[model samples]
Every structure is written in C-alpha cells, then in structure tokens.
Target: MSSVSIHPTAIVASGARLGANVRIGPYCIVGENVVLDADVELISHVVVEGHTHVGAGTRIYPFASVGHQPQDLKYKGEASRLEIGERCVIREAATLNPGTAAGGMLTKVGNECLIMASAHVAHDTIIGNNVIMANYVGIAGHCRIGDNVTFGGTVVVHQRTRIGAHAFIGAQSMVDGDVIPYGMAVGNRASLAGLNLVGLKRRQFDREAIHRLRAAYRMIFSNEGTLRERTEDAAELFKDDDLVQDVVAFITSASDRPILVPRNGQVASED
Candidate 1:
C-alpha cells in the first residue's frame, strides 16, 4: 500500500508521482506531469501541473493555482517548467506561473521562502532563498528577487526589476526599478528609505557590518551624489564586503530605467 494519504475528494491523475509520506487534501488536483517529493503536503483546492516539481517537505495551502500557465501575452503553449525548492511554505491563494518562450524555460522559487496569501509570481521570475513576501504582493515577469528579503503587503514589482538580498519594501509599494542589497524602499515608484536595519537585525548582522551598510547608504542617498560618483565612492569604501558590492553592482548594472532612488522625507501609510 502506498504511504501517501490522498483524500478521496482530491483528484490526482494516474501518471503523477507522489513520493513517500505525501498528503493531498480535499478537492486538490495533481496533473500528469506533476511530481511531489517526500513529506510534501497539499491542502484543499490546490492544483499542481505542467512539468511542476515540488521539492521535499514543502506545504502548499488551499486555492493556490501553482504551475499554471504564464500570464504573458507572448506565451505560445510551450512546455516550460515551474520549480519550487525545498521546505518552502506557499500560503493560501498564491499563484505561481510557468515560464514563457520569451521569458525563459523555467520559473523557480528558492528554498525556505514564505509566499503569503494572494501573492502572485509571474512567468520566469526567479525568487531566492529565505525571502518573505507579505499578502497580495505581485511580482511581474522576469524579476529576480534575492535572498532574505521581506516585502510588505500589496507590493507590486514591475517586470525585469531585481530586488536584492535583505531588502525591505514597505506595504502598497510600487517597485518600478531594481532595489539594491540592504535597502529599505517605500512608496509609489519605491524610493530607498534607508538601509534595511530591522532585516539585518533579524539576520544577526554584527554592529560593524550594519554600520558599514549605513555608511554606504549615506553615500548613495544622503550625500546627493550622482549614480556614477556614489558608485565610485562606494566601491572604494566597500571593497572588502561583498554585500556592499551588491549595492554598487545593482546600481551600475541598471540601464536607462535607473533603479528607484532614495526619498528624503516621504512618510508611508498603512491604508
């Protein structure tokens, strides 16, 4: 007898592969090409299909339309894939789409990220490890989100933007540009508010590293330096720390659509 406990109400196709100790709750559907690894749990009303692979120990909650078709207009019914990494918790009603031909060959969610309810990750967006996305966040096509980042509720990241590691984006924020490492960006068009201090504390960064990050933020934001001058100065100051180098690199790599700049005195609300 199979150790998988699939509820009678769930509909799993015969060709789908469920590994050891997997559980499928009521009304969930696993399609032919889906693969659920060991100890995975799918709660009610979930759908996994289309070359999708759910890694070990992951828990997918109710009504998540994961591994669905990419929302891009250019998709031509290709057999692209969706890969969710190990031990990740996908909360209620989150949607993860497959990659399109123009986007890439796959859309991946990295290990240990918590994608909250109603958040949508579009085609070919690659999410990194240990990130936390609050409710109703929407990441568009081809965005690259880095590790240990936290996004507040209803955050809208535009297409092709890159949000770096340990960044904090406030709620209802619109991210039109790339967010640098250790950044705290808020508001419409999401300007940098400061260094992500609370996030660094959660990661247990030492005082010295935090200070160095703050100094780099000062050069980038407070000094009113142009992108080129600030980057050159930051390179000289942060040659030792790779994290600081991430700040410089993100800024320099940005094209004509420069990443969001920091705003000095703008206040954010929780409405």
Candidate 2:
C-alpha cells in the first residue's frame, strides 16, 4: 500500500503521482496530471489541478488553487504546466496559474517562497526563490520576479514587468515597469524611491558594500545625458561591486517594459 495519507473526502485521480509521506487533506482534489512530491501537504479544500508539480516539503493552505488554467484571453486550453519549488508556503485562497502557449508553456515558482492569502500569480509568471507576495497581491501574466523580491499587500504588477532580486514594492503600489535589483519602488504608479537599504541590512550585506551601492545608485539616477549613458557610467565606476553590477546589468538588458525611475523633481536621498 502507498504511504501517502489522503483523507476519505479527498479526490485524487489515479494517474496522479503522490510520493511517500504526502498528505492530502479533506475535500482536496488532485488532478490526473498532478505530481505531489514527498512530504508535500495540502490542507483542507485545496485544489491542485492540470499539469502541476508540487515540490517536496511544500505546504498549501485551505482553498488555495494551484496549476489552474491561464486567465489570458489568448490561452486556448493548451497543455501548459505549473512548477512549484520546494519548501514553499502557499496561504489560503492563493491562485497560481499555468502558462499560455505564447509564453513558452510554463509558469514557475521557486523554492522557499511565501505566497500570502488571496494572492494571484497569473499565467507565464516566473517567480524566483525566497520571494514574498503579501496578501491580495496580483501579478499579471508574463511577469518575471527575481529571487528575494518582496511585494507589499495589495500591490499589482502589470504584465511583462521584470522585478529584480532584493527589490521591494511598497503596499498598494501599481508596478508597470522594470524594477532594478536592490531598488525600492513606491506609489500607485510606482516610482523608484531609493536602494532597499533596510532590506540589504536585514540580509546582512556588508556596510562597505552598501556604501558603494549607494554611490552607484546616485550615479545611475543622476539627471545626466540619458539613462543609458548614466547606466554605462555607473557600470564603469562600480565595476568591482557585484551588487551594483547586477543593477547596471538589469538596466541595460532589453525588457518589454520601461525601467522604473524616480518621478520628476523627486530625488532619492542617500542612506
């Protein structure tokens, strides 16, 4: 007999693969193409459907929906997939959807993520490890969220946006563009505030490194020639700083959305 523990009221398709020590709680539904890796736990009333793969040690709270169809109008019932990495905690009512054909066919959430209640991660979204999506946050389709990113409650990220690692989005913000690594964005239509100094400090970044990053930030956001020119100059000046290098690289990369910067006449103060 299989070692998986499944409640009598749970509906698990025969074709679903449940690894040892997996637990399916009451009224939960596991679809035919689903795979729950070892130690995965679904609390009551969770629905994991479609071609979803839940990684080991992940715990999903009641009423969360995983691997559902894309909300995209262009999606046509294709066989796309959703992959959740290990040790994730998906809270109640969170919805994670699969990718659309036009988006390369997969939506992915990396390890150690905490997706708070009622958050919606739309089709084709790629979330990196250690991300935190606060309650009621909504990420539109095709967004790329990097590792260690933090989204405050009710923040809405537009489609195709790229949020770099260690970036912070303030509560109730509307993000429609690219946020550079270690940057802080705030406001309805988000604008770059400054470096996420508090975040970096909490993460144990060295003081000297933080100092250099602040200098680089000033150079990049200066009202100089063009953003490209400023970025190039910052890159050259901070070539020895790894964190600054990441910010410069993100700025220079080709993105579908424009880069987020401070609003006109608003200057970011040094940390």
Question: What lDDT would each prediction earn against the true structure?
Answer: 0.87, 0.94
lDDT of 2 by residue, 50-99 (tens): 99999999999999999988888899999999999999999999999999
TM-score of each: 0.93, 0.98
Please report how far candidate 1 places residue 108 from its true position, in Å: 0.5
Tens digits of per-residue lDDT for model 1, 138-249: 9998999999989999999998889888899999999998888888888997787777888788779997977787777667664455668977888898899777888888
Provide the lowest-lDDT 10-residue window in model 1. 262-271
Best by TM-score: 2
- Which stretches in model 1 have alpha-carbon errors above 4 Å? 222-225, 254-257, 264-271
For each candidate, how many residue pairs have backbone atoms clashing (under 3 Å)?
Answer: 0, 0
lDDT of 1 at 15: 89
Off by over 4 Å in 2: none
TM-score of 1: 0.93
